[model samples]
Target: MADLQVEVMGKDEGVMDDYIGKFTLSVTPGTKEVEIEGTVFKIVMGTFWIKIESTPSQDKHRLQFPYLFDGPIHYSRHYSPAVGLLTNFNDAWLYSTFIKGVPLFFRNNFQLWNRKGPASFAVRPGIQAGHRLLYARAAGNAFGIIEDTKGVVELLHTGAQDDVSGGGGPNAQRRVKPAVYTYIISAEDASFRFSETGAAFFVDFASKHALHSNCAEVVRYSGEFHPRPEGGWQNFGDFTPDDPVKWEFMIDNNSGTYAPDKMLLPEVKELFEFNFPGLVVRALDREDERLVESREACRAYALKWRGVRTDELQLHVREGEVTLCRRVSESGQQEMKRAKDNFT
Candidate 1:
């Protein structure tokens, strides 16, 4: 469901500056005969094949299985610091074990999903079994600067002792601090410029659903902005008499099964507000209305080939042609059609 570009670079006259033609490749696992247009070339050993294997499962919310796909899922459940420190170790382990098979978190592959409801804003810790709270705290650094559970527990104890004789009324309950999420953007190269002064940056969207499509549409963003007093623009800039500019942008979800990434919202807002002055930005993850329906359609298309062995699906490419043929247990052969749904 995506297009890939293959660029050929050559060394000519000891300069290594020769530019060869570029060819496009389909995203699906298949083979296709391609022509090299230039000097005379010999075609020797022009055969290759690819196979996709997986244990079929009917769990719609299953984000990942190591035996099926070999990578960690993008989603994780997070707990508030106070609550996390107070949780019992046995209770956490039991909860993780029970929920790992229940499929609470949504699956994310190829693209991110922003569900259309209040659930998108809710955080449920230890809900994803594959990534439990203990694993995240010890391995993934989910608790921010608090590296380990011991540090969190120590902090909680210190706070409780301090609150016992603190200057609040005897009837007043001690308040537990909530976790805060901070956004940090870093550049590897120091010379790289994010934007030019006094210029409007345009956001663009390109769909991966259709092959042979090279067109990218400009994204229109709707938000407010206030001018900075010194020079450049900043979101919620510190300037008196702040007047907000309202702007809107368009989004084309050609890959119907996925939505815009929520983590990128801060970066997107920064890209626009920092580049364009007097722009006040209030950004949210835009969810598609038909996301569930589109996702189900794509999942159905992929699951149709369930129970079929990996070797059954075969691909062969020769002489400017590509063919995907399925082998049956009997003696017959059937040609499988290219995937139309934007699933894989």
Candidate 2:
């Protein structure tokens, strides 16, 4: 079992606020599958409060909806967990995927801003309204820049790459670079006024020109600012849906699942258990005598009892417990369950 702790902090009206969260992943001793669970807590008015939590079910796991903190004009966050992804539903939604064999986790602090009134940070990208205004260029080896009518914003690579290659033609072999850029802004001013303005300016510029269409990939608008006396570049945060244009920008450029080869074995097992309780019970009972046996022997017994080839079956054993899985025809599974139930 691997454990990870996540924390987020911010300041409001000179008062400090914080959130603490943790998640754990437990892997079977000899298998690549894992079970995940976690919870999150926040400090409200100087007291700790439970925000979100997850509990394992008899046959599956359920993740609780995340809560947003409302306190002293500070940052707030939302969370959601799906089949293989966990997301921080903030203005700049951060998410991570859970691949079968990979252990993943993330933690970060963001200075939140409210986009409700005139004091809020807002921008109008020119693309939606048909205007050309953004520009980009690779600068030496340190970073890049995205500039507009307002000013120049430095950008860094987030190590995330996307290929926008279209139909093959004369330029089929051309090397295409990723379009995403990390906008760097100063956070010393204690507000997102400067960063927001710069982001809006860049979006407007990128919307009008074909040469900078790649700029559309710049869905994430992050910054660097001084949080303490010893100043260093830290990611303040990214643009969220508060800005209608930025929201549409992400929807148009950054929405989709990247897991093309994700496995469906677990999902199939769930379906089988849901519809074939009797057959599943019989199968479990068949292996009850071998419950305390070794993995190799138990697996062999399960295979022989099921009379299914290895490719069609998945036998998982952990701590003297055995689970039988196989790709049975939907009708066959239903019939088996029905037959078992009627047998006595």
Candidate 3:
């Protein structure tokens, strides 16, 4: 196995004007994973840019283009232990290595998608992950979706929070910002077949929380897209889906809670009906007596129907605990209830 280690430093230096950090990146050719461990020495009141290039020429291009890249890369961060919850300082920084020799492609443009006010919707083309694999996130919650020739499958959902505020102090309400998220797709993914030529790579966005019509607001959205090498990297200009996919959430006022639903706006529904004649969207009602009895069971049922593996789906009915279950049939709502009861 081939291995390479390198040290990375932040761009700026002044104690109060820049970020001082060190990142050690280790690349393992066998597993195709890069492990990054580092420390964030100091961060000033400015955004920091970290770039890793294969050659000096590439580094120069990165400096000039900033957003363009040509290589396999993975980025992840861990809190700094030295900071220990200190304000304005992350404790640590950790990143993963590249996997499968797949070079991650990034879109140079930094665009923001916002839907001005409450009860509104916006549709945009999502990134194409070659094989339907898509990485998406909203307000810090990250998840992946796999949509093959068969249908769409929701991968594991992570960073689920009961309260949108994330349990901050009293000022949390004031600090609340509209959810802004992004998605990435691999241009080489087979899923690009579903996208229009030249506009094959894309990402979609939607606001999770409804804002008052009277309130003035805007949520900034920006991120990079990883394109596969098979097609090289095609710059199709800005992303605009021919048939915009709408993601709607099912919110039951009676329960005062919300969950993703199969509901689609009339126009979006019509577009899907025409484009994907075989597409099926299951409607799950929060008011259903059986579902209300076991929210986890409801989630399990919904996820199973959507092709999520039983082991991949986890439910936490209480604090600091987890429950797992096998697949249940549509007629086995009772079985799900029993599983929930027994587990809890």
Predicted candidate 2 versus true structure: per-residue lDDT over 204-231, tens digit per residue:
1322111122213221112211111011
**Candidate 3 lDDT score at position 204:** 17
Assess the local accuracy of residue 166 in candidate 3 as a C-alpha lDDT between 0 and 100.
Answer: 20
lDDT of each: 0.25, 0.21, 0.23
List, residue by residue over 207-313, the lDDT tens digit for candidate 1. 11100011111111111121121221222222232112232211122322133345545555554343333334444443544333333332233234223222212
lDDT, residue 15, candidate 1: 10
Which of 1 and 2 is the better model by TM-score? 1
Q: Give all candidate RMSDs, comma-separated.
A: 26.6, 30.1, 21.6
Model 1 residue runs over 4 Å out of place are: 1-39, 42-257, 287-344
What is the Cα-based TM-score of model 3? 0.20
Which model is ahead, 1 or 3, in terms of lDDT?
1
Query: Candidate 2, clashing residue pairs?
Result: 91-240, 126-204, 133-205, 134-205, 134-206
Number of the top candidate by TM-score?
A: 3
Candidate 3, residues 1-344: lDDT per residue as tens digits? 22344444443211111223333333322233333343443433233233443433335455555433332322222222221221122111211112221121222311122343222332111111111111111133222222221212111012221221221212211211111111212222201111111111111112211110111122111121111111111211113221232322111212111112223223223322332344432223445553243334333443543344443322112233221111012213554576699999
